[model samples]
Target: MGFQLTADGFAKTIDALKEHYLIYAPVLKKGTGRFTDTDIVRYDFVNEASEIELERKSDYAFKEFLTPLSETLLFFTEDQVKAADIPDKPVLIFLRSCDLHAVRRQDDMYLNNGWTPDWFFKRRRDLVKFVLIGCKKSYQNCFCVSMGSNRSEDGYVFSVETDGDGFACDVPDTGFVPFFAAGQAADIKPSYVTKNDFEVRVPDQVPGAILKHALWDEYSSRCIGCGRCNYVCPTCTCYTMQDIFYHENGKVGERRRVAAACMVDGFTNVAGGGEYRKSQGERMRYRVLHKISDHKKRFGENMCIGCGRCDDACPEYISYSNILNKVTDAVENLGKEVQ
Candidate 1:
């Protein structure tokens, strides 16, 4: 069902939903941007309709609610171990079409990649639902059209977009229909970006020789190994475990699963002081290939949903989309060399 709601009606609807679901949406955070005196739009819990930043593309992805940057998996004592408690309240996350597609990538990694689903991730995933935030226009650095993630027809309870002085919603899930009962019924379809400012061409296959390609060397000098890209990427799921011990006792502590980035140093560190992919170039190569090529080999689809948060987060201004094109060019060049 579709509905056309007045601003007040929408606010009331949000108010009613709050009674049951923990709503999260993009919020304008003042003075919290990378630059001084700037604002950034990122995901945060919202209690009302007015709190959601609907005009801008979120600087961060909604993946944090599902796969937090730092999550306590379990608490441990000298002789006892207990899993950390998760909140029983269900969650509702508002996100765009690209991010909706990114959720599939996340599901493939945590729920389907291995023999057993991650218990911690599954618990959170089960409690969560999605709300599609319709994209009226393409944002800067976005290539969702090329990635085929600019439109999401399903996977959300409802789809919402700004309409005049109010909102238009397509409530596919019958369970949520009553929330918008006050609104006027209408035939509403969520808006989607049909095109982006630019396009990215991912090669069908990336050859092994591309690993030694000169394209990666540029990133070695240009990239400072900040790892901001991995942090912002909705699909990057790498994590490292930490055993946090109390100062008074060593055995009693909590084991945390902290987000990890392959671009950063010490990520490859192992026993006996050994480290793999020592250079930033090698790290860059690994990350790029994994996004465009390696992941598809395993999951039958590219991991990158092309939301371009990595481009937005990179302090060094390295363009991941450009790197993907470079990889494509290198693949073509390698084909010529083989011929």
Candidate 2:
């Protein structure tokens, strides 16, 4: 069902939902950006409709709630080990269409990658629900239309967007209908972007020779290896483990799974002081291929949802969409040479 709610009505509905779910939405954080006196939009807990930043595209992904930056898996003593505890309360995450699609990639990694699902991830995933934030217009650096994540018709219990002085909501789950009792029922469909400001051409296949192609060398010199792109990417799931020792003998501690970046230093480090993909160019190649080719070869779909947060977060102003086009052009050139 659809509801046309006044601002007050939506606030009341949000209030009602808070009793059952911990709602998280994009909120503007002032003076917390990379620059001085600037702002950024990131996910945080919200109590009312007005607290949600509905107008701006979130610079950060909602994956933080699911796959936190640093998560303690278990505590260990000399003779005992105990699993860490998490809240029993359920969660509702408000996000855009591309992010909703990114959830599928996350599920594929955590739930379907192996014979058994990750118990830690499963516990959190089971208690979570999604709310789609309808996109009224494509934002800058967005290439979701090209990546086929521009529309999400299902998976979310409801959809919400700003409508003039109030809000428009589409509640597909009957369980949520009672919360909007104060709002007027209306014919409503969630808004979605049909076209982005620009399109990205992802090559159907990347040849083996592309690895040695001169295309990657440019990033080596340009990229500073800050890893901002990987951190903001919703589909990047790499993580590293750390055992935090509490005692001098290192007998008591907690094992933490911290988010890792492929493009960052020490990611490819192994024993004997060895590291693979040591160059920034090689790391960039691995990152891009993992998103577009390697994951697709395994899961049958491209891992990139194309929300363009990576492009937005890059301090060096490197355009991921443009690199994708370069890959496509290189692939075409390689094909012609083979003929």
Candidate 3:
């Protein structure tokens, strides 16, 4: 088991982790309108307390470190084939509990379910470290409490907090962290949530003749075809490929992976000029059901960590909770009628 780290001890853990791994935390970028107010991952440099934003979750998630927006699966020339040189460096990412749950769900799909989890994620999983910070209070649209993901635990290599004077540190593992000034550990009084606290009432049997429910139609209408929900979600894994030819040297070009979304209009389009989910409503239904219904049937739990990012990122103001809970209740009512 990992040791309990106080605020200062946690900082020392970060310093130690950075020695071998590339440390990435949320960094704010400013510029033109198109690029302004975005979170970009960068080398961990400053240990300044001012730069830490543990009070609120980052606008972007840490999944990008493992599954990048653009990735070259395999490159090919005229005849012979060779793997592209994507860095396999282990990357240490600072994340909240909701984000950590998202990672667990992703691992169920990619590694256990065979999407082939990236070494960047796996290596980091083995060697990378975590510096978890407990949320003192809830942030905007944060439904972590509702989803039972509001707290941190010993899974982290280090944990931190602020008291009146300085900080406290714990190295549960076997390492030294020096990022924080040493002080007495504060007694944490964080809130906790349980599995049965606020469940979505997933059916014991789903996607087994219940796929064509009317709830799909209603949920689809509120969808504006925006992909913001996917962007903010930690477990929504969809991506598209891109190939750009340099004007100067067309012979040397790399294929990249760009993030894809189910809500996007053309998301389901394929080679035969056929669209898998042509209608906006169909796309929305696909995403929500995939999270709560389909994913649960295969895996033990719903893929959604219930971060409420879908509700937060929606331009059309669609609430995933309202839609999913309504569907569950509707299905229950339908079952009673059948009986």
Candidate 4:
């Protein structure tokens, strides 16, 4: 809400922020190399700035920073329960607006959704800062214009952009009071983005409507059920928990939380060895509708940020946005359908 800064001042501002918080940014890696098994672990980049890939959004989103892919919420031994340490060190994450919006949905789920659990609230309230990155162009399969989550100002503590000689730092009004009160209007205007054209505003009862449409079966028939979309999406937060027993210490063990995808094979296997949504068609319907309908109904926003990583992540070109648009066009043409 202050003056827009030149670019050079922006970089210096964030460089200074690194001292107080660890910055996790889009660091580029080689095409072929060792891949970390953990989705939420820190990324390996070739370099910090110019070397980092900015042309396209990263395949992965910044959700891991807020809700870790694997976290030890609590430890229970012989009826005694104790809390585990969630990452308390303040973290600064660089993210695109879509990813940032997805972060808000997660916030709503953990904090705003209902009873904010003490364990989740503790980690979230204390240890995170956001650095919003600007999107200049659409990459392989972006459809951010459709879902309307491509812009934001809610979460970032320090907003920055490239200035002529250095970097521009825009400290929002609230953040400026204590340390930056005396400074002249050093407000920064980060790079701006041109909004995409298409929009997806499905009806309030879209889950029921989508099920009624024949398109669900048509588009999903090609799905091989690899579950790549769920893995790559910035907003997909479902996870499965597993317990391990140590051979040496029979009484001692550890619990692990792994990211889960409804689309994955064997996704529905339970303790009794039962599976739900056994066919690809059913699995596909479950995922697409959940993203476009069920989540929006509860969160008041579509969970898919329209980052398009799902389309890119898919081996089959099953773009969820395509289905959304097709559904809109079909529903609008119901009169023609009767004629």
Order candidates by lDDT, high to low: 2, 1, 4, 3
TM-score of 3: 0.78
Task: List the candidates' TM-scores in order.
Answer: 0.98, 0.99, 0.78, 0.81
lDDT for every model?
0.92, 0.94, 0.63, 0.64
Candidate 1 local lDDT, 8-35, one digit each (tens): 9999999999999999999999999989
By TM-score, the better pick of 2 and 3 is 2
Q: Per-residue lDDT for 109 in model 1?
A: 92
RMSD of 1: 1.0
lDDT of 3 at 121: 42
Please give, for residues 1-339, the per-residue lDDT of candidate 3 as tens digits: 223455555566556555666666655443411245644332233454445555455666767766766666556554445566644556556676777778778777666776565653454356455656555555556666655566666566555544434333344544533333343334444333443223454555554445667667765567778788898788987777787654455555556668899888888888989889877767877887788777887887777776666676676778777776776787787788788
Worst 10 residues of 2 by lDDT: 45-54
lDDT of 4 at 151: 67
Q: Candidate 2: lDDT of 191?
A: 99
Clashes of 3: 15
**Which model scores highest in lDDT?**
2
Better of 1 and 3 by lDDT: 1
* lDDT: worst 10-residue window of model 4: 38-47
User: By descending TM-score, how would the candidates be arranged?
Assistant: 2, 1, 4, 3
Residue-level lDDT of model 4, residues 8-36, one tens digit each, is 33334445555565667776555432244
Per-residue lDDT for 156-191 in model 2, tens only? Answer: 999999999999999999988998998999988999
